[model samples]
Target: MNNLNKELHLTNRPVDMPTLEDFRIVEKSISELKENEVLVKTLYLSVDPYMRGRMSDAKSYIEPFQLNEKISGGAVGEVIESNSDNFKQGDIVAGMLGWSEYNVVNGHALNKINPELAPVTTSLGILGMPGLTAYFGLLDIGQPKEGETVVISGAAGAVGSIVGQIAKIKGAYVVGIAGSDDKTDYLMNELNFDKAINYKTTPNMKEALQEACPNGVDVYFENVGGEISDAVFTMLNKFARICVCGAISTYNLPSNEDIGPRIQRTLIKSSVLMKGFVVNDYAERWSEGIKQIAQWLNEGKLTYEETITEGFENIPDAFLGLFKGSNLGKQLVKIAEPTYAKL
Candidate 1:
């Protein structure tokens, strides 16, 4: 076994947008696993928009990444060694793990994945965080009834794409707002969204949203908050529901400058309900969400996409690309190929 490991550590707290310079690659010897621990060979690593919040020291639902310490997030790997009965060599697992080629993690924190049931990588994408986020946020928060209009910003993204599909499955008219022409095409042609607006090219966002949601939006999945969300707020129907999943547009801005038009009166007059949430809020119901999403996949009622960046060295690059709208769907990094398991 290769005892040497390379881990990515956060060296600096990013002021606005994170850059490669903020991270450092450190080479060290892998430590022996203790009792109830497993050494996993990372197969794939997920880079998400939510990780940006963890980069800052600001208090959030989750803790911030300690300076000069290993940055950890969602990872899928093959267990090369295990000290716990729950896991054994060659077992595929998914968990929050360090950004290293190999990680020694508590076996209990890892969930064993059956590779034969689905692609192992799906554990980090559609069948994982992104999929669960879409499922619960839409159904629980933004309940879309038949014939209702659902508008989603960042529509071509991992969570937003899934949200649009689930809304369609629930018999609602889905409208997506994306950044590029390719994304708009994907939302309209591939996902079958009723209408797709390319925010980058659209001169007037409110007018486009009004035209797309002719009957007014009954559900708004708020992914990219800012002008797009402002536009969505205008078209919200009476008693409309808004699932606040993310705010990527203002993630890099200073708090004071991130201010937008006050919508208190809009929510009052329209009786709109907007609630922000992190996926962990529904941890107790994750299995339920996963089962439903899996059923949808089996019935061909749902689909997903992934933009994978090859190589461990490029993980930081892949993460940074999220702000640039470089990925069409879930963005993941291919760390290394599994030696014992078939993928």
Candidate 2:
């Protein structure tokens, strides 16, 4: 066991796109565990689109990351030392931990992972925030029904992929819009999406969407805003429900320059319903979402993919990759190997 811990800190904020120089990796000595705290060795760290919003000073659903501070997000770790009765050494847990090799966190802040049920890494992806985000945003807000046409932007992404699959399970004809032809093929061939559009290659997204969704879009799972969303808005049927989960296309742009087509007229004319949400809004129902998603996974109704990057030193690169469309699914950095396996 090592006595030092390495952490990645945000040194500078980017004006346009994030670069590797914006983050600095530093080494520190691990401290002794407190009475109610446990010492955790990080295994997997999740890099998500929402974290990009936190990199800036702009006010939003969450607080911005402070300069020269340890960056934190979803992480799955193993408890190496415990001072709390709720947790024991060798217990696998997941929580909002730092971009570090080890973290000393309060036991209450971490949830123990049942390795017998699923791989511990999943606690950072499908069985965690991403899964919950898809569940509430799609089922609660979009509300796709039988024979409805569902459209998902950023459909190759973590949350969007799950949203499309859930829409299919509800008997909807799912249409996915992705950045690459390979992603579109994966959506149709692997995920069983009814149709898919490669936004980058399609000259006229509106016309392509019109041809694919003959009946118009009943539910729109908005992940990437801007032109893709503008095209989707034009094809919305009466009483269409739009779940505004994310707008990744504009996350890196300066706030003043982050503009897109206004949908007010479209909403009014079609009587469409649009609502933006964060996963924390459904915090109380997290277990419910987990149970359902887990059941689906066990029954082979749900499938997920992860793009794993090895080593903690590459955390910044993994995060920056999110905007470049470098990953096909959930992007994660593997920090360390699990010391104990309960399963």
Candidate 3:
């Protein structure tokens, strides 16, 4: 922030995989914090698939990242300086910090975190946006019923993985579809999913879904919306609820005119209630989900996994990995660590 340190700042728009050249080092004088503001030293950064949508210059649930601007998302950092009565110099908080060494945050924009239960890093993973997406999206949209059959695509991802676990805990039979065997193993073994199917290896998805959910899908957690979801659509039971959380499979495609899944006819016959949601739609209830997730983590009812990249230089790598299904869990970046480290 001063002559002794510099920040890695984004300088260009990246098509897919961004390189160091896409960013530049910027130097600036450290300024004193204003009233109700806190200076935070960045510790962890979140790299998610949704950020990809944000990078593109398109109108959606949120605004796109401007070219040559320092991009920001969810980040965990320590309060190095504070002017607010509510926070102190050593408190840790999570909020929208940009891709840099430090950021000034209004006290209202930051949420203080407890470091003991699962590690402060988990605040960027299981206790972060991905976790809330899974919690509210499934409960509020999917409305999964006990003994009902629930199917989730992108089963190994941050949101999808937790969706399966919550469904199982609600007394529903959960089945997950992923891209690799190791992910399938994680879903079946570690997460305790009732069954896990490898979509890359399976030749017929319709048959796989039918075999996995002999009773038919009662709640569809739509994580990937390509041929996999098309097949699952045909297997939905009457009055099924579909939570359209994401469409990673269709994201690369230009638009719905080219890549959206086709199957509205099945929806009419099954009387399915399919709803698309952005997690922020329930922003008023964000804390409720976080509190519940924290309770679940404390109770050992939920386990979280993360694929963390160690530096800001690798932010792009961490991001692009989501599309290739290379990450087994939540993907994040550790931008800096002048002090914090795993014990």
Candidate 4:
């Protein structure tokens, strides 16, 4: 097989602070596949906040990305060569493939997707990890009940957007908080979130939450932690459920890791049940969650957004965009043409 030889690496060009060029892609040979391994070329690489956590050496749910080394994440790719019966050449698959244009990984790690059920990239977005995260996080953790009020921050992004809609599916009144009025409008007008609040434009977010909920937030699916969370925290009703998903607002902070809403006083008064989670905790039930979200989508009950960048080389920039709020739903870098998903 002819090797397509360029790969990206991290560059220190932005100085101590990491930036896109911090990684560079150089020519390399097509890796020799070991027994049970497959040489895969990435088709679409996902850019997510969890990748940002992996960039820093700080203690996190997983080991941080190694400095000046090739970084990897969830990606859709084509299997060019395979040594295992489970996979074959020309197979379109999704796995923990990385930033590179190509990679060689365990045959067990890759799951081949048939191209009729959905597009190939959907495996890296709504049909894959992010979809599962929103599904299980809201249903299993947040436990939204009918007629209850559910509020989500980062409500226009991948996870929060699904959380809000799933809450609506359960017959809950869903309110969303986003950074811009455009995002607010989409959440309300297009995504069908019961109400959308532009956090930056609102004079009093707590009042806005109060107005939206009317009865108070019964389930708070928090994604952006900081001032937005502080306001939502103030409106929590008795026995409220809180799922702490992602904290994009403070992700770029230079220091100060201690996190709690400024309105801690409200927690004591409301007796809210709060739990922070990394989505992988539900990886065991991943199939069930994904099927449910997909069924909702197929039935037109769930809608998703994807801010896609076209090319493999733009992975770093795509990941950076998450912190800047440049994406509408799931942010991804497309590396190849679509493979029709069958199931």
The candidate scoring highest on lDDT is: 1
lDDT of the structure predicted as candidate 4: 0.81
Candidate lDDT (C-alpha), each:
0.93, 0.91, 0.83, 0.81
Candidate that scores best on TM-score: 1
Evaluate model 3: give its TM-score.
Answer: 0.92
At residue 151, candidate 3 shows an lDDT of 94
TM-scores, all candidates, are 0.99, 0.98, 0.92, 0.92
Runs of candidate 2 with Cα error greater than 4 angstroms are: none
C-alpha RMSD of candidate 3: 2.4
Full candidate order by TM-score, most accurate first? 1, 2, 4, 3
Candidate 1 structure quality by residue, lDDT tens digits, 12-101? 999798889999999989998899999999999999999998999998899999999899999999999999999989999999999999
**What's the distance in Å from true for residue 33, model 3?**
2.9
Candidate 4: where is the Cα deviation over 4 Å? Answer: 1-4, 12-17, 254-264, 338-343
Candidate closer to the true structure by lDDT (higher is better), 2 or 4? 2
Q: The CA-based lDDT of model 2 is what?
A: 0.91
Cα deviation of 140, candidate 4, in Å: 1.5
**lDDT of each residue in 1-343, candidate 3, tens digit only:** 3523345556765554455576666666556778999988888888777776776787898998877667788999988888989888778888988777788778999988877666887777778788899999999988888899999999999899999989988999999999999999999999999999999999988888889999999999998888888889888899999999998876766674345456678888999899999888989998899899989888889997888889766776777678889898888888777454231
